[model samples]
Target chain A: MRVLLAAAVVVTLITADLHFNKLSTARSLLDAAATPLYWLADLPARLGDWSEAQVQTRASLLEENERLHRESLVLQGRSLQMASLQAENVRLRALLNSSALVRDDVLVAELVGVSPDPARHQLLLNKGASDEVFVGQPLIDADGLLGQVVQVSASTSRALLITDATHSVPVQVNRNGVRAIAEGTGALGTLEIHHVAATTDIAVGDLLVTSGLGGRFPVGYPVAVVSEVERDPGQPFARIAARPSAALDRSRHVLLVFIADAQPKE
Target chain B: MDDSGYGYPVVLLTFLFAAVLAILPLPQWLMWGRPEWVALVLIYWVIALPQRVGIATALLLGIGLDVLEGAVLGQNAFSLTVVALLALVLYQRVRVYGLAQQAAIVFVLVGINQLICQWVQNLQGVGARSALFLLPAVSSALLWPVVLHLLRGLRRYYQVS
Candidate 1:
């Protein structure tokens, strides 16, 4: 018997992605149907985590508590400064008669799971389409950029970390104002600034931030620092590498930022 | 040798169990090595009873996997259906193959399943990942003997008339 079932899949792939849309919609429904099971399965893992947390050393817990208290004080001071700055900016914008910008409504999500493959680094966020979160929305943790929602279901979504091999972002050097695109090199803890001319005034220690050149990522967030710059006098593009500011290995919770009325960055 | 009347319910129970395993959330670091538990159980049944199990079972289960894994909708379905076809082909003779040979064949089939998965990702317009993509294939195949044994027990437990 000719089991051309596999052939049908191949044909579907060749025919165009449109036919796959219906199948995807159907699978999405299945994904929704499966959410309760996902939550139930997560119970044991949550229990394991609770047990582990209960075993933290007393001294270490005290130290962490002290650290958090100190951090909270610093944050309180910063928030006061931020209030003053916001008032000043609003006064200036009002003087110029410019409309106030619409602030993004952020949905906080806890990291639930990660991509099963070690070769790739992506994360599953607790919020999903059901939470009004959508794909293409940028994710930001306390430190800085986490990633963006690439795929979202009703109960959860997946963020492709900027460190992931397939991810790319537009960036600028904070010092020189030089713009470049940073691409993920498929490793944890590293990214490459591609297409820098040899004559480019690139230097180690230059801070790279989201340039707002790409409408995807928000402007002025810290992305990476030029940790090493090797200009092979022989090659056209300089070999530039940097580290992401967000600790891709560590952050447990993040905010999915929806720019409520963000005009596409020019 | 047919238990569609009795064993089918056990198979459904296994399906639920596998789906639950897939959905179980863990801390970010530990979630990476999660096993393909559902695929293993489905493959076991298809091999054990060719007459009782068929293509639609694989497709539906693949949909469940797609939802749980959070891959593009049809990606798991595509890879899993491919697994079902191959497993069905080997169903009758797979039992007679000695332990070592069986283990090797299991590895190859699991590897093929992973490749089908990679292919599906490419179709979904994602980049190809490291060779570490094959890690689950080894883990799943290494798990085959145990998964098979456990299912046999479940079959007996639930199928008792």
Candidate 2:
């Protein structure tokens, strides 16, 4: 009995991954069932957001206002100094406008849930295919590139974060424009730059951003900041590490960069 | 299988709940440390009602997890099948043990389950895992007593055969 059961187990492993192979219709039903559950699972966070907004009472608001006023005064003083360098910054932005890029139309989506599986770092967003969210759309946080949409549902979608061990993006050093592929180091705050030559002019603290080589992400979102550089005389590649831009845990909201033609071309 | 109290319908409902739990958007920080809720619940069923759940059930859930996780289709199904086998092995001997002993046995099974997950991940060529993942294994196992208690209560209170 056990032998047959074990054989059946092997068969289950082989055939069970329904894999959307013949279950296309079933997936839609699954998504339909998931929509209300997404809202339910997100209730705590939504309530948190609501209560947070509610918790800032008049007294705290006045205190916050006072602090903002003081901070604004200091920033105003700094603005005069920045005005002198404003032209150069604008010129850089203009220069970056073409070869490099920045986001234009973005929809901020609340991250509703995440896969707890350590192997895959993916997110469930409140936005879905119904919201014009499509595959290959760049998901980013305020800090940097998060991941792109891999699956779409009517009410929710899945995003693979950059820190997910499975993900890789082509990146360029902001300082020298030296391009290399940055792979997830399988940690939330870290990435590994693959095959940077020992002779490469890379340095610690150099900024790394998407190079748009894969054309999966945008031209140049700040992806990471190089944190370490390990050079071995015998090894041709320098072991380099960078901090990922998106700290997916700290914030509930992120921007999904929506483009007219969002599909990535080979 | 659909009894008024406990049966296939309840199992199906659990799958729906597990699927929702499986796909909920997690924040970046907590993403890696997330627990396999579907796996946990399914393991409970396998341990509780072996007749209803076994390799085939685990495989189906694994496939669902695969589509939900967006990995190669069979990756989780394969590992889950392995877990189902573990549950079957433990099912016989586990009943003889005390609650704590049963929980401890479950802990070992969870460890093996996590090990299988790591192995599957390695095979998939995406292997930057932390030891923190074992946290869920421990956590899910530790919860076994409570899960069994609640589920047993349901089985008794609802009076399903």
CAPRI-wise, candidate 2 is acceptable
Docking class of 1: acceptable
Off by over 4 Å in 2: A1-32, A63-103, A259-266, B1-40, B67-72, B85-92, B128-132
Model 2: per-residue lDDT, tens digit, B1-161?
A: 56333556676776777777666656555655555677777777777788778888877787667656556555667667777888877887777779888777767776776677666667566654457767767777777777777666765665534
lDDT digits (tens) for residues B7-101 of candidate 1: 46667887899777655654554544556777787788888766666577777677567666656555666667777888888877888887666
lDDT, candidate 1, A106-146, per-residue tens: 77898776665454567777887778777688888877787
Query: What is the per-residue lDDT of model 2 for residues A1-266, given as tens digits with 9 covering 90 to 100?
Result: 75466456544443443322544345545655555666766677778889998978899989999999999999899888775476666678788883323335799998776665656677878887778888778988888888888667788887888887778899999999999999986667789998888999999999998897876777778999999999999998999999886766665799989654555321
RMSD in Å for all candidates: 3.9, 4.9
Number of the top-ranking candidate, with DockQ as the measure: 2
- iRMSD computed for candidate 1: 4.2
| Interface Cα RMSD in Å, per prediction | 4.2, 4.4
Model-by-model DockQ, in order: 0.36, 0.39
